[model samples]
Target: MSFSKIFGGKKKEQAPSTGEAIQRLRQTEEMLNKKQDFLEKKITEELKTARNKGTKDKRAALNALKRKKRLEKQLQQIDGTLSTIEFQREALENANTNSEVLKTMGYAAKALKNAHQHLDVDDVHDLMDDISESMDVSNEISEAISTQPAFDTVDEDELLAELEELEQEELDEKLLDVGPSVSDRLPDVPSEAPAHREKAKKVDDDDDMAELAAWAS
Candidate 1:
């Protein structure tokens, strides 16, 4: 028999990719949701009919209730199928996402490896150590430049004492060069009052006249 004949004259369908499978599952979920909605509406209608026919027509009410039960069962089955399909779709999506992430991470790892191909750990460590040493040296140089000059060879207290003595000597020399005070330059004056001095002079004159008269007699 020919291959086509052996295969019933139809080719086997190709397997779906992950994306196509997910799409189909979503379509099935939509269909089941529609069916569930329809069954729910039918169940509601049957329940209402049964309630309305209650006690009035026992056969009709029982039939309506039976129909409602059948529709509820169908809705429950659709719900179950929808749950299963949704779980499967979610699991597939998660697997696909994880696969893509893993692939991207693998590429990143390869690129990183290539980037480090020319680098040696020992050489990198040596370079970093050299950089650290250079930074330390630079900091030392900066500190030296910013520091004030030392006065280690000088004596501050002795220098200040000598300066004060020199200042005192200069003041003494200036005082010696200056003339005497105004009181010393003025003429001497009598200790007594002017009226007393005049009275003493008159008394001495009178005594002299008396002596002259005595002498003449």
Candidate 2:
């Protein structure tokens, strides 16, 4: 007979969970409601008895009315009990819902923690720095390839000067080509058409005068 065995010998009774408690409360409400219905039926029967016996037997009708009144009191008690049970049941149901929600939230928090376990701010920063360095190297390589020795870079001012010189040479050549043709199409400097026309008229007048003098002679 040890003292520990005597004191801790009985196993404790486990309390009902929120869901179980709510179910019990609902069962109690249903039972009270059934009892209330039974009471109402009995009251109706008592009222019918009183109505039937009222005229023929007054004493019997009084007794029936008294029974009806007692039945109504029982029915009112059941109504109050049912209201209490229903309120308790709803409260238990809300508690159960909140408990489940808390459990789900706790599980979600744990999952999120596990997912981010291997990630740190320093690791993220290092990864971003590596990406930026790689990008910089890539840009440098592209610039080097674009500006290779195989490609020649011409000065903009020299190119403009050469273009202007070519335009002037083309203009001078066009002027030279047109100069001889335009000169060849021009008339001679001295004109002889008027002098030749006056000489012919004078010769015709002298011939006409000589004919007239011969006729006179």
lDDT of each: 0.92, 0.89
lDDT of 2: 0.89
Q: Specify the highest-lDDT model's number.
A: 1
Candidate 2 per-residue lDDT over residues 12-57, each given as its tens digit: 7899899888878888888888888888889999999999998899
User: RMSD in angstroms, all models?
Assistant: 12.2, 12.0
TM-score of each: 0.63, 0.65
Q: By TM-score, how accurate is candidate 2?
A: 0.65
Model 1 RMSD to the real structure? Answer: 12.2
Clashes of 2: 0
lDDT of 1 at 123: 99
Q: In candidate 1, what are the lDDT values of residues 1-217, reduced to their tens digit?
A: 7888877776788988788899999999988888888888899999999999999999999999999989888888888888899999999999889988999999999999999999999999999999999999999999999887786567889999999999999999998789997888999987777989899999999999999999999
Off by over 4 Å in 1: 1-15, 49-61, 147-154, 177-217
